[model samples]
Target: MSQIFENLPVKVAELPELTPTDLQPIDKRYLKVLLIMQSIIFTLLTIGGAAIVYFSPDIEPTLLHFAYACAPTLVLWGLSAALTLKGFKKKKYALRERDLLYTKGLIWSVRTSIPFNRIQHAEVKQGPLDRIFKLHSIKIYTAGGSQSDLSIPGLPEETALRIKEFVLGKTAEDGAIE
Candidate 1:
C-alpha cells in the first residue's frame, strides 16, 4: 500500500503559459456588424421617444422637454457604441496545449482560461446579426460552476468549427487509454 501511494502520479492544472500579447484579435467584420445592429436599435429608440413626446396629452411639446427625455438615451447609446467598437479591438483568444485562453473588455479587461481536460462540451452559436456577418461564437462548458465556462465571440464560422473540433479532439485524447 505504501509503495502504491508513493508511485502515484500527481497532476497540477496551471493556466496555459500565454499572454494577452500572444493572442490573436477577432475578425474585423464583427465590429461592422455590431455597429449596424446598434444603429438599428438606436433608430427605433429615438423614434419611440419622439412618439412619446408627440402623443402625450398632458405634456407640452417643448424642445427643452424633448431634449431632457432623449438626452440620456443618446448619451448612453453613444457611450455604449463607442465602448463596443473599442472592446472588439481588444478581444482575443488562443488554443494552447492544455487549455483555451480568452481576453476581452474595454475599460475593465478580463482573461479566462478553460483547461481541455476539464471541458465537458463545446458549442457553436450564431444570432441573426452573426449570420449576416458570417460570424460564430464558441461556448466551452466545464464541470464546475457556470462562471467557470468561457464564451468566445466574433470568430469566423470556419474558425469557430476548427476550434470546436480541436477542443473535442483534445477532450477525447485526454480520456483515451495510454
Candidate 2:
C-alpha cells in the first residue's frame, strides 16, 4: 500500500492582522526604572572620565580638559535617555487564546509570537531594581534550550504571576509539560 501527501496553499490576504494598537502597553513605571538605571550608568562613566583627565600626566587638569573628557559621556547619555523614553512607548504584549505576543522597538520594530503547544515552561522574575519599582518580568521557555525564548519585562508583580500561571496551564493542557 502507498500513501500520498497533499499540501494546500494558504491565502495570505485572508489572515487576521496583529496591529500595534491591539496590544496592551506595559506599566508606565518601567520608564522610570529605565531612566534611573541609565542615570546611574552615566554617572559612573562621567566620574571615570573626570578621574582619567585629572590624573593623566600628559593632559593638564584644567576645567577645559575636564569638560572635553566628560563631554562625550554626557552627550551619549543624553542620546540614550532620549531613545529610552521614546522606545518605552513601543513595548507591548498580548495574551491570545492560542499564543503570546510581544512587540517592542522604535526605529526597528520586532514582534514575537509563541504558541502554547511550543511553550515548555514559564517563570516570573524580579531583580533588585524591579523589586524596588514593584515590577516583574515573565520569561517563557520552549524546548531545546536553557535560555528563555521570550521575556516580557516591566509588568506589575501580580500581572506577571498571572501571565506565568496562564502560560504554564496552557502548556500543560497542550501536553507540552509533564
Candidate 3:
C-alpha cells in the first residue's frame, strides 16, 4: 500500500510554460465575480434561515432546531465556492494534432482527451450575455454523448473563430496561427 501511494504522480503547477496554450485563459475577474455571486446567495439563504427560526415558534420545539443548525451552511457554502475557484485556476489544457486535453473541476479534477479526428462539427458561438462579457464559446461536436460537445468558453471572438476554423480545416488569411 505504501509502495502504491509512493508511485502516485505529483501534480503539475498551473502557470503557463509558454506564451500559448490550448486552454482558454479565463479572466481572473470571472472567478472573483463568481465568488461575489456565491457570497450573496449564501447571505440570502442565511437570512431566510434565521427568519424561519425567529417566526416558527411551533417547529422550533423539535425539528426547527435542526433548521437553525443549518445556518452554518451559509459559511460552508461560501468557503466551498471560494475553494472551488482556487482549484479551477490551477487547471490547464493542451491542444495537439491528434487530440485535445483539458483539466477542469473542483475536488474531482477531470482530465479529458478528445481526438481531433473524431470531431464531426464545430462552431463559434456568442450569446447576448457572452457578448456583454466580451467572451466567446467554441463548441466541438465529437462522436459520442460522453464527450460530445466541447465548449471552450471565455475566449475572444477572433480566437474562437480561429479555433473553429482550425478544427474545420478552414484557414484565415493569416493561416493557422491567426
Candidate 4:
C-alpha cells in the first residue's frame, strides 16, 4: 500500500521588533480569575455528575476515570494561560502610526493590526470593578468586526483616555480606514 500524507499550511514567523510595548503587563490576576472560574465550573460539573451517578451500577469507578475526564481541561487551560502570559511578557500591545496592534497569544499569538485608515470611531469604557481597580478598557472601532469595536481591558483610566485621543487623532488624520 502507498502511504499518503497531506501538507498543512504553515505561518511564517515575524522578526523581533526593536521597539517595546506601550502598555504595562496585563496583570496576571486576570489569568487567576479565569483559572479560578474554570475550576469552579469543573467543580460544579462534578457535583452535577455525582448527583447523576449516585446510584449507577454499570461503569467501574476508578481514579483513572476522574483524572481522564479532568485532564483535558486542566491541560488546555494551563497551556493557554501560560502562553497568553508569555506573549504578554515578550510583546507590548500598543498603537503605532499606521496600525493599532493588539497583540496577545502564546504559541499561536495574534497581532490585530488595525490600520488607522480603517478606524471609524473609538470609545472609553469603565465598569464597577474597574472603578475599584482604577482600570478601564479602551475600545477602538473599525468596520471589520461586528461593530468594529475592540476593547483591551485592565488599563488605567488615564491610559484609556490617552488611547482614545490617539485613535481619534489617527482616524481624523487618515480619514480612509472608515
Candidate 5:
C-alpha cells in the first residue's frame, strides 16, 4: 500500500524550551583539579624556558632575563586559570526522557542534544586527575559516528555510571540495539 506524503508546518511558539536553571552543574572539585593541572603545565613551561636560557651560551642567564622570557607564559597561564574558573560554572548537563543535553562555554555558549534512539553506546571514563578527585565523565556515541557525540565531565563516579546505564537502557528500549 502506498500512502501520500504530507508535509506539515508546525508552530515554533508551541515548542518547549530547555531552561538554563534546570541544568545540573558539574562537581565543584573539578575546578580544583583544573587549577592543579594548569599549575603543573605552567611549571613545566617555566622549567623548559629556564633550561633553554641556561644552556644557550649566546643568551645571558640572569634571574631577570629568565623572568622576562617567561613573562608571556605567565600571562597565558593566568588568563587560562581565570577563564577556567569562570567557565566552570557554565558546564552543565541534563538528561531528558527522550534525549540528553549538555551546555558549556562562557562567551560563546553552546548546547548540544542527542536523542536516545540515536545513541549507539555510552561509557564512563576516569583519568588520573579525575580519579584523584573521584570524578568521572560519560561519553555517548551515536549512530553514524566512531567519535563520541557528547562528553559530560566532572560527574561523580557513581553518577557517571548510572547515567551511562540509563542511556544504554533507553537505547535498548527504543530498539536501537540488539
Candidate 6:
C-alpha cells in the first residue's frame, strides 16, 4: 500500500494572476440607501435595549447600564458605516472574453469569476428597499447548487438587466441554455 502511494504523481492546481479590467462600479445612490437602512435598524435596537435595561428591577439604572446600552450601538454604527464606505469602493464587476468577474468585500476580499458556459440562468431581483431606490441585483445560477452562483447587489435597474441579457446571450451561444 505504501509503495502504491509513493509511485503516484502529485499535482496542484493554482489560480492565475488576475488582469485588471475596466470594472464598472455600482451606483452611488446605493450608499445612501444602505446608510439609511443601517441607521433605522441600529436605532430601533438601541431603543429596545435601553428600554429593557430601564425596566429591569434587578438591574439598577446606573451610568454603567446606560453606557452599555448606548456604547455597543454607537460602536456598531461606526464600524458598519466605515465598512459600508470601504465596501462600496471595493464593489465592482467586469465582463471578460468568456467569464464574468464580480469583486467585493471590506476586510476579506472575494473575487469570483464564473465562466459563460457554467451559467445555467440569470435573474434580476428587487426588494422593497431596492425598489424604493430603483436598484436591483442579479442572481446567476449554475449547475452545482440551489443558491445563486453569484449575486451582485447595488446595481442600477438598467445595468442589472443588461448584465442578465448578456449572460443569457452567452449561455445561448455556448449551447448551455435549457
Off by over 4 Å in 4: 1-18, 21-24, 55-91, 126-132, 144-149, 176-178
Please give the clash total of every predicted structure, in order. Answer: 0, 0, 0, 3, 0, 0
Question: For candidate 5, what is the lDDT?
Answer: 0.86
TM-score of each: 0.83, 0.88, 0.60, 0.61, 0.88, 0.82
lDDT per model, in order? 0.84, 0.88, 0.64, 0.63, 0.86, 0.84
Residue-wise C-alpha lDDT for candidate 5, range 1-178, written one tens digit per residue: 0123334365544456677776899999989888999999998997888888989898899988899878888999999999999999999998887889999999899999988888888989988999999999999987776654888989998899889889999888875445
What RMSD does model 4 have?
9.4
Candidate 2 lDDT over 1-178, as tens digits, reads 0122224365554556676566999999999989999999999999999999998899999999999999999999999999999999889999888789999999899888998888877889887889899999999988997654999999998899899888888877876445
The candidate scoring highest on TM-score is 5
Candidate 3 lDDT by residue in tens digits, 22-120:
564455444544565577778777777766766876666356575665658766996788786777575565665556566677778786766676677
* N/CA/C clash count, model 6: 0
lDDT winner, 2 or 4: 2
Best prediction by lDDT:
2
Q: Of 2 and 6, which scores higher on lDDT?
A: 2
- Candidate 2, residue 110: how far the Cα is off, in Å: 0.6
Any idea what lDDT model 3 has? 0.64
Candidate 6 per-residue C-alpha lDDT over 16-123 given as tens digits, one digit per residue, 9 for 90 to 100: 445665687888888888898999999998888888789989878898998887789989998999899888988888877678888989889998888888888899
* Candidate 4 structure quality by residue, lDDT tens digits, 44-82: 766555544444576445666556555666676667557
TM-score of model number 3: 0.60
In candidate 2, the residue pairs with backbone N, CA or C atoms under 3 Å apart (3 or more residues apart, or in different chains) clash, namely none
State, as a TM-score between 0 and 1, how close model 2 is to the true structure: 0.88
**Residue ranges of candidate 1 with Cα displaced over 4 Å:** 1-16, 19-21, 175-178
Number of the candidate with higher lDDT, 4 or 5: 5
Whichever of 3 and 5 has more lDDT, that candidate is 5
Candidate 1 positional error at 106, Å: 1.7
List, residue by residue over 63-166, the lDDT tens digit for candidate 1: 98789768877887899898997788788988887778998888999988877878899999998999988999899998867878888888998999999999
